[model samples]
Structure formats: C-alpha cells, structure tokens
Target: MQTQCGGCKQGGARCCCRCGCHSTAASGGGARLCSLSIPSGRSRGGGGATEICRSPREGTRKAGRQAGRMATRMFEGKDHARVYQKYRFTPQEALQKAVFSYLDRKAGAFGLALDVGCGSGQGTLLLASRFQKVVGTDVSPAQVEEAQQAPHPDNVSFLACPAEELPVADGSVDVLTSFTAAHWFDIPRFMREAERVLAPSGCLVLTTNTLDMRLHFRDRDQELTRIFQEFRDLLTPYMSDKVRLVVGDYEEIFEAVPFPSKERITDIVDKVPMSVAELVGYVQSFSMFQAFLKDRPEEAQAQVQRLQERVLEAMGEASPEARLEFWNRQVCILASRGPVPDHDPRS
Candidate 1:
C-alpha cells in the first residue's frame, strides 16, 4: 500500500519530532500519542513534497546539531569489536525470510546488497550467498577489520565509513539495510543517502531487536527470566538516550525514510539456542554493559558474577554450560525506493 505526504510550506508544517517529543511508551508496547500529534493526520514535511504521518523524524548533516549530537562512533578497538563478534549473534533465518518476503525475491536472487553499520559483518556474510556481491560498511574500523577477517564468500567486502557518507555510487545498490544500528545515525542524512543509493526497484530495511528479550529453560522460565531482566536493569543507567529510538520500535528512524512505500513489522521473533554462559556473554556484549564495566569496574564485575550465580541457581544447573534459550522480538522497517522486484512465489 502507498501513502503520500511530506509537504511543508510555512517553515515546513513538519510536526516532525512532535511524536518523539510527546509520545510516551505504553506498558504493552505502543506510544500514547499526544492529542496534538495526530499520527494519521496530515502534517507538513521539512524536506519533501508531502509528509506522511507514519514516520517520526529526520534532518540533514548540516543540521545535525538540531538532533543534539551527530552521533559518535563507538565500539572501538580490536578487543571490543572481537567481543562484539563473539557474543552478538546475528538474527538468523526468520529475519531473512521477512526481507525476502518484502522484496518478493527468492534467496540468492538479488544482485547486490549493502549492510550499513554492519558490525563484525555477521549479517553482511548472511547476504553474501544470496547476492552476487555484498559490501559491508561500518563506522568502526575494528568492526570492518573483523568482518574482513571473517570467513566469507568471495563476493563480500568490508570497509569503514560513516552511514551518512556512503562510498557507494548512486542508484547502484539493489538493497540497503541497517541492522541494529540506525538509532546511532544522523537519521536525516542516512535516509537521504539511502534514497540516493538505491535502485528504483530496490528496497531499504532497518531492523533492531527489542531489549524485551526473554530467557527460557524447561520449567523455571519465570525465575530465570527475572534474573535476566534484573541483570539487564542494572545496566540501564549506562544505556544511551539514543537507545530510545529502539525502545520506541524505530518509529523515529522510520519517520526519516523518504519512500512513499514503507511498512513497519514489529512482530518478527527470532529464537537462538545458547549455553547459559553464552547467554551471559551476549549481555556482556551489550554496549551499555561495556559502559558499565568502564565506569564501575568492580561493581560491573560483581553484577556479572551475581547474574551467573542467580541464573544457575534458578536453573538447578551445576555449571554455566547448561542449555538455554534466547528469544527476541525484532522491529523491522521495509521500504522500497520505488517498485519491488517482479517476483512469483512459486518460482
């Protein structure tokens, strides 16, 4: 379905950021929109002709200060990137299926794919076999280096570059994606660049898994889950305000996409199997947790220890090697530059 908007005259009727500025998080996942911020009502656009009410906010690099900070590059150094690589598991088949379904293409059918903010290239490699050539770009040099060093198909390459300043030629990318990283971007610039780089029939995907993650085992799911949440809660103070974009399910980022054809799917669920220790490692991989460790080393170490101890006790496991389940609810935004590829399901 197509919706048209993005027009602003009187300094742009842009009710933009009107959402982020007013909407509060509901207990069950949704925004309680301020009466003045009519989501379905026509507002003005600051950059385009007509503004659709679906998306939340955006502006250019020259105006990065408008968004406060232009976003600083984090996850530096080989040690940190390697920790990210080892603990941060990529979303598997389910995510791919959602993208393919949106693109209306079979696996391995697309010509080129670009994964922006691709940390460690895990998701970039996931696209390699599917596309004839795949390039992963990240702001972090260490991340790019790690991705380059990973075992990957000959079609894939990695480089360090900011998302707003893509090195790609215009209209050259068939599919563009940012996984779990758009929140940290200068949204307006990145969105503009996404439109510039995509083929007319290309699509854009931005996905981030919500932190409402769950822990599971045989029968003691509730207690185990509590242990995980409590552990995560302790790390909350270290989380950046930028993470609010994710907590809001990328509505703000989605607002930036210029495409008239776009959809947000908040129900994509990804399940990963892991050992209890690995689950803890995944949390350790969190940027917030890393920050916690930096600011409060002894306390951070104690928290990790406490988490392992509590989780193990709850599971009646003697060691951290016991099997565990990691489940996440992912938020995905799929938008086409124009028309999606002509595709037949049975083909």
Candidate 2:
C-alpha cells in the first residue's frame, strides 16, 4: 500500500507508481536517470535509465503554485459569514443519530473528534455531545470567529485551517466528520490529511445534502415544488464547480477516499417544517446566493422578491406564518482506516 520514490525513499515525491521510477535523483543531481531496473518492452530502454529533466527551480515553482492554490478560500467577508450563521440550519437529529450509531460500533478511542469546514459551529456542537473533545476548523477566519462566538460546550473549540493542512498530530483523531463541506475541499489532498490524522480503525464520515430539494404543501405540493425548482435554476449560474460534486451525490469524493472499507449512502431524506420567510432565508444562506448578491445586487434582490411573492401568493397568505415541509436528500460517505471487527449490522 506504500508509494515512494526508489531513489529518495520518500512517499508521494516524484514516484511513478506504474513504472517505479524516481524522477528526481538522490545524489543531488538536477536530473538523473532512474537507477531501478527497467522491465523489457517498457517506456525505458532495456536495462537503461531514462533521464528525468526537471530542474530544482522548476520543482520549487510547482510547489509554490500548489501552496497558493490551497490557500485560496471560496467564501469570504464578514457579512457573508454572518448571513450564513443567521440562516443555516443546525444538524438534523436523524443525521446526528446515524453518525453516533456508526461510531459506537467501531472499537477505538472516542476522546477526540475533528470537524473540518465546520461553519458557525452548528455541526461541531453536535459532536460535543458524543465525543470528549471536538475541534472545528474552517478556511474562513470570519467563519471561525463566528463559530467561536457561538455558545458551545467546554469541549468544543474552533480554529482557522484548510482541509489539506490540519493543525493536528498524526493518528491522533478518533473520528473525523465534515458536514456539507467536503465538496469545497481539494479531495485528494484532504483525503491524505484524513489518513494522517485518523487513528487505526477510526471513522471518517462525510455528508452533504443535495441541491435537488423539494417543498410540500397541503394540496399545493406540485406548485410549491415547481417554484422551488425555478428558484434553484435561477441560482445555477452562481454555483461553483465544487457544488457539482454535491449534485453528483459525492460519487467522486467516495472514490477519492483512500480506505478500502468505504461505503456511500444516498437519498436519506429529511422533512423539515418551516415558514415561507424561513425558507427564503435558507435560500439566501447559500454561498452562491451571497456571491450572486455581490455580483448583481439589484438583480439578486429582484429575483428574491419575486420568488418570495410567488411563494406567498401560492400559500394564499400575506403572513409568513404558513408552515411548509422542506424535504432534503442527504448523502453520506463512511470510511474507516481498517475493517471494524464488530461493526453494527443494522448500520
């Protein structure tokens, strides 16, 4: 299972897994011919080494570019962070129950849990009830500050960190969870970080609710659903490429997980009752919606007003007190470092 360069014996450093060739030389050469024996009929000449032509300066530049890209944050500004905190829903009880049930079956320490990309500590607080300690990390300093301000248990703390580079020790985390946030991460790099921080047999739970949502009303379910779809379509242009991964139900993310014992559960629907105004606020909480507001304030405001007016008209009430059901379909990807010997059969 280990991947390393033959010359440097360093994993994930210029090693070609297929040919077992080390692109960089271990003897301080700018480029070197791979010293390993080449198989016949391979890309390299028979019993001869193919020179790797990358210079040290070129490698440094490539590393710098990657670091810069990793530092880039999608959601910014204090105003947007405040909007998120105001409108985003807390972790559903059903989802929390499912996560705890899965973790209970695994034979490992439950002392520490890491919640990556935890916005405003909504999901992080849920972990505090189960684990002895919970640390939430996000790339946005504004979001981290907001999370810190929220009233949470003594065991819960918030930090500003990227998914690829966590401020944690190797194999020290008992459970790692990301709620509706993995889509915004660099999947491959984040997976590696998960591998590094997770203990043996530790669980990695990643979940996200899909954007293909629906709304239900008494005898007006069809009309409400249509209106919601229209609203979703209108916001489509504002969605980033990462959002497409959530739309795909995390299929690409599941594949990126390094664990062999991994499973994906999709279409776990939850019905939540809310008023028309609350639903409008939920839509406004979306990162893309905020981005749209920044890019086209007048157009975004008009669209929001139009959607709100249509919903209120359909409900046959000027008051926002009419209760409607919001059905959210969530996808969960569960993985562990090793096979659980006594996993719950029902889970």
Candidate 2: the clashing residue pairs are none
For model 2 the local lDDT of residue 142 reads 65
Candidate 1 versus truth, CA RMSD in Å, comes to 14.8
TM-score of each: 0.77, 0.78
Backbone clash tally (model 1): 11
lDDT of each: 0.69, 0.71
- How well does model 2 score by local distance difference test? 0.71
Off by over 4 Å in 2: 1-68, 343-347
| Candidate 2 residue lDDT tens string, 251-313 | 999999999987888867888889888888889888788878989999998998888889988
Candidate 1 lDDT over 76-191, as tens digits, reads: 65778898888888767788788777766522236668898889987887776666667776776567657656676666765555777765556667789888988988888888
Off by over 4 Å in 1: 1-70, 105-109, 341-347
* Candidate 2 C-alpha RMSD relative to the actual structure: 13.5
